[model samples]
Target: MATTSPSERLLKTICGSCLILAPAVLLVGGLLHPEETTNAARQFEIIVANLGRWELAHWLIAASMLLMIGAVVGLAHLLHEHRPTEGIIGGATTMVGVMALFAIASAEAAIVPQIGRSGDAQLFASIVTSGGFWVLLGPVLLLPLGLIIMSYGMYRSRVAQTWVAGTVALGSAAFAVSLPTGSPVAFAIGLVLMFVGLARVGWSVLAETDEQWHHPPQMGAQLAG
Candidate 1:
């Protein structure tokens, strides 16, 4: 049997963990989120009332984005052999979207809390109305788009179960739409589905032997020959 390198083993562990943990963390964050309202002042009041939970939730969400970056790259690597084009494009696009969402979550966790602490509803409202906020938010749409593309690649490559790919695509779309539409029910459903899909992938990764994880079967065969 071919030996697995230490680095490969570590990489596999990290990616597998991220795939499982990212969605789970995001779910916790979503569940912890306080009530939101259309009114800026009312939203600020809600934040103030549940300050600790609010900050923790956004911070968790930001962390999940960072974790998801690793998960997406791992997925791309898995798909590269069978569907290189989709793997690369989907990974890059998803990375950009995840990073943008990370910024938004960070701002909410760090800056919004400060604004609420200052009791500046008008300032918060002004910031929201300003074009810059929406500009920052727009890239988030890329997340669902990338997920759908990636899921299609997974389906075509037969790397994952068809149901898994379908669930991820549907969940990502629902999650993205829920954000702008303020549909908490959809958000929760999306996260649950995503968790189910990703956890299966993660489990598969974790089940791989170090040698199997390090080299694709074809590559291993080539090396053996």
Candidate 2:
């Protein structure tokens, strides 16, 4: 049996915790998010009305993104022996997507409040319509794309159950759709499904024995033969 080093144990614990918590934080943020309308002026009004909640929610979302990045890395580490290519590519892509989301959340949490308080809906609308904004937002699509890729890899590797991987992919699609349409209900549902899938993964991670958790990738491959 492979001995578990302290560092390995610590990393494993952190990964499991992140998988369990990230989705919960995102779900809370989504639920707290105010509904939006097509009218920039009305959107501004809603923001101003729920300024504190809005800021808090976006901040939570940003935090969740950071945690998600860590979770992705952990998952990639686990998948390395089984599907190295997918693990590396999917983890990198997901990290990029999560970083883009963090940027958007930061703007909404820190910058949007100021804009809302100024009551200048025109400015907000203009910013939203700008090329720069779209450029920054474009990478958000990678989140769902990377998730699908990673989930498919997990399925192929038999690391994750079919239903679990499917749920993650489905949730990613729904969440991606919600982003463009600004649908809070859809966001909430997506988060719930994501939570279910990730929580199962987290549980599996936690259930690993010390020897299994610390097994070297090369050793894992040899044992599989």
Which candidate ranks first by lDDT, i.e. highest?
1
Which residue pairs show backbone clashes in model 2? none
126 Cα displacement, candidate 2 (Å)? 2.4
lDDT string for model 1 (1-225, tens) is: 767778877888888888899989989999998987777778878988888998999999999998998789777866788878888999888888898889999999999889888888899889877877668667887877787788888788776777878888888888888878889989999899888887777777777776656543332122121
In candidate 2, stretches whose alpha carbon ends up further than 4 angstroms from where it belongs are 215-225
Residues 137-198, candidate 2, lDDT per residue (tens digit)? 57987887788778877777777677878888888888888877877777777889988888
- Backbone clashes in candidate 1 total 0
**Per-model CA lDDT versus the true structure:** 0.81, 0.80
> What TM value does model 2 have?
0.90
Off by over 4 Å in 1: 214-225
Worst 10 residues of 2 by lDDT: 216-225
